[model samples]
Target: VKSLEDFYDMEGFRDKEFDKDDKGTWVVSSKIAIQKDDSSPLVSKNIYLFFNKNNNKATGKFVLSKIYEDFSKNTENEYRIAYSNNKIELLDNAPKEVELFLKDYKFLVEEKSFKSLNNLPKISSRHNDNLPLYSINYLIKQDNEINKWLQQKYKFMKQDAIMNIENSGELSNSSLSNFYFKVRYKGKKEEIQYFRESINFKPSKGGY
Candidate 1:
């Protein structure tokens, strides 16, 4: 069985320095299981490796993003994560070696009523026109390819597997749960092996 380390190696992540010439930014996200407070249940917290070009070298910082909690109680408590301004070098074409010390994230949430009393109004509307157009199309095409492969392998009727995937939220060990596993396993094994060696796969625990 493949582990999370294997998944990261397969993804081919590079330092933000080589990513874009104009934007000069790149971000990769991952989720880890953790408890928010003593009384709260464990939830997957989102973390990001954010990199941006700083002069000739790329600097990176580990950011602790927010989590979706208290959903059953119909309250969204915003978490404020604080981190130092310290950053590490992760430049492109440089020796892949760096040490970074991540401080423990501090979570803070103020009362909802307190915000309104202070004259801070929430902004609800956002401009969707600026969103990337290709991402939705790409996911749709991938889903179609996966569904096509599944139907051919299992003799599933049209739209049957698609329905199962949509309705199978958080159901582990089922067809929907194993969707990611299927994506990696769908391609030809020999071709994947050849490609993997070309990229120089080295498993490291840094930046994760």
Candidate 2:
């Protein structure tokens, strides 16, 4: 495997503007004007793709960062579709495990077969911090209800519950947007358009 320093010193990326993060991941940064036409006060984005070098292979499993500036409300969001093992992993500015778990959970609940899990997709974000302290009783009631529901389901529900505890958390709008972008980008890329049509890609909703 080629070391981080060695990979950065290689061709193409030798003089390219990039950074080595604390974890020694190579981050290639770039910016693109996302606005349509020569619109005034143009909106652009700073995109960063993190990679881990292994011999001649580079894994983009690290986060692909997208920072937008002065974006318009009417502008439709676009995302780059990641296929195979090149799928994005960490999302910037959040807990990596939580983000990945939520992303995969969304995929499992929405895209996977109905037999995957009963009532998994119905998980909602109705509970808020503003609730009264006495809500603890209702919270425990909720937990008992969930436990009963799981007990009535598959033998693997225990492990699933454990994994949820370890990896799940409140899904932020930005983190969720990162997942949306990776799965569906309506950009000028021909390959992306091809995949959108071939895969019959459509944006999903209401699976928090």
Candidate 3:
């Protein structure tokens, strides 16, 4: 876990770049997903690794961090830590509460992709809502945890779903097709409509 060999041998590392120090300022760069949070709804977090001039350890590491409340969400932020002069400093302006948690992340090399089962959405519960629902838009009505997990899973499955939509014939839902719904939001009745044909529906990218 302490040597460059251990790092290079780890699994599920997608892309990589390298450079040598004394010869050309040694560096190794790659991308990986690491579960660096427990309290956060996010489980699979993107991490960018950069190791320059030091092979035994990395010189720069960044984590895709999140800040969310109620239904509003943000994951664009990144928590960065860089190694310099034999010391590592948390460089990103993460919230004070999250800043301290970064200190406990995987400091050593990981042999596998970090997966957080606790945070993963239970598919059964997610799709079992009494109210009729379609993909992302319907998810917003769900609670915070389900909302976060739905957005996360949708981000991964959107392309496939789009392909299905493209190949499939006749998009119709009983509730949507029949146009029979007495659904209300916040005690106010809402009107529902359905179109005979379909258009490429792209859910709001990410932030749900």
Candidate 4:
């Protein structure tokens, strides 16, 4: 999670500027969402500030950087400035005071449920043809080993799960309709349960 002040503090941000159209509406600027390294996972999120020629304050509409892409359109009369990953989205009809208030506000990571299995038996008879009958103690150790392996695998899947949540925009428990864990022995998917928290853009008046 990062704040708008943090965003502005990044190198080259202060120099970024907005471009306007013939009709006086701001055009999407190249300054929006600068990806300097191109190889870096982090990208700059940009908010185009449009203003009246007669007034230094906003004229109304503005354009924001889009999620998963590069651009989105909005108006001050119809939207507020907010961050989502390396992009921005509209917040319906937000006031200037609210926008200013949020200028330094940081985005908090939103948490979602992540599920995988635990306590699975290793070398199940269903899969292994070998009949090396094991003692209860050995079986327990095998189960523990299997669980450890699953945890390692699940860690790799965390990024993908977070990406899915971002793309879908559905954070409800019911919306978590995917699995990343499986048990080879029983041919059954492992049931997992955990929570994922990632920085997400949303309109807020401060407290959770």
Best model per TM-score: 3
lDDT of each: 0.26, 0.26, 0.31, 0.27
**What ordering of candidates by TM-score runs from best to worst?**
3, 1, 2, 4
Instruction: Write model 4 residue lDDT over 110-200, tens digit each, in one string.
Output: 1112233233233332212243122111122322433343335332222111111222122353222111222212111332232222222
lDDT string for model 3 (1-208, tens) is 3543333233221112222222112222322232223334432333343442223344445555444443376565567676544334687676764465445333222222214433433222222234332231121233343223323532221111110011111234311111111111121122111111121111112111
- lDDT (tens digit, per residue) of candidate 1 on 38-154: 445543333333333232222333333333345564322222222224322223232221122223321111001112212322222222333311111111132354445434532
For candidate 1, list the clashing residue pairs, or say none.
Answer: none
Better of 1 and 4 by lDDT: 4
The weakest ten consecutive residues by lDDT in model 4 span: 7-16
Higher lDDT: candidate 2 or 4?
Answer: 4
Q: What TM-scores do the predictions have? A: 0.22, 0.20, 0.29, 0.18
| TM-score head-to-head 2 vs 3, winner | 3
What TM-score would you give candidate 4 relative to the actual structure? 0.18
| Stretches of model 1 off by over 4 angstroms after superposition | 1-23, 34-42, 54-70, 74-101, 104-208
Check candidate 2 and list the clashing pairs: 79-185
- Candidate 1 TM-score, true structure as reference: 0.22
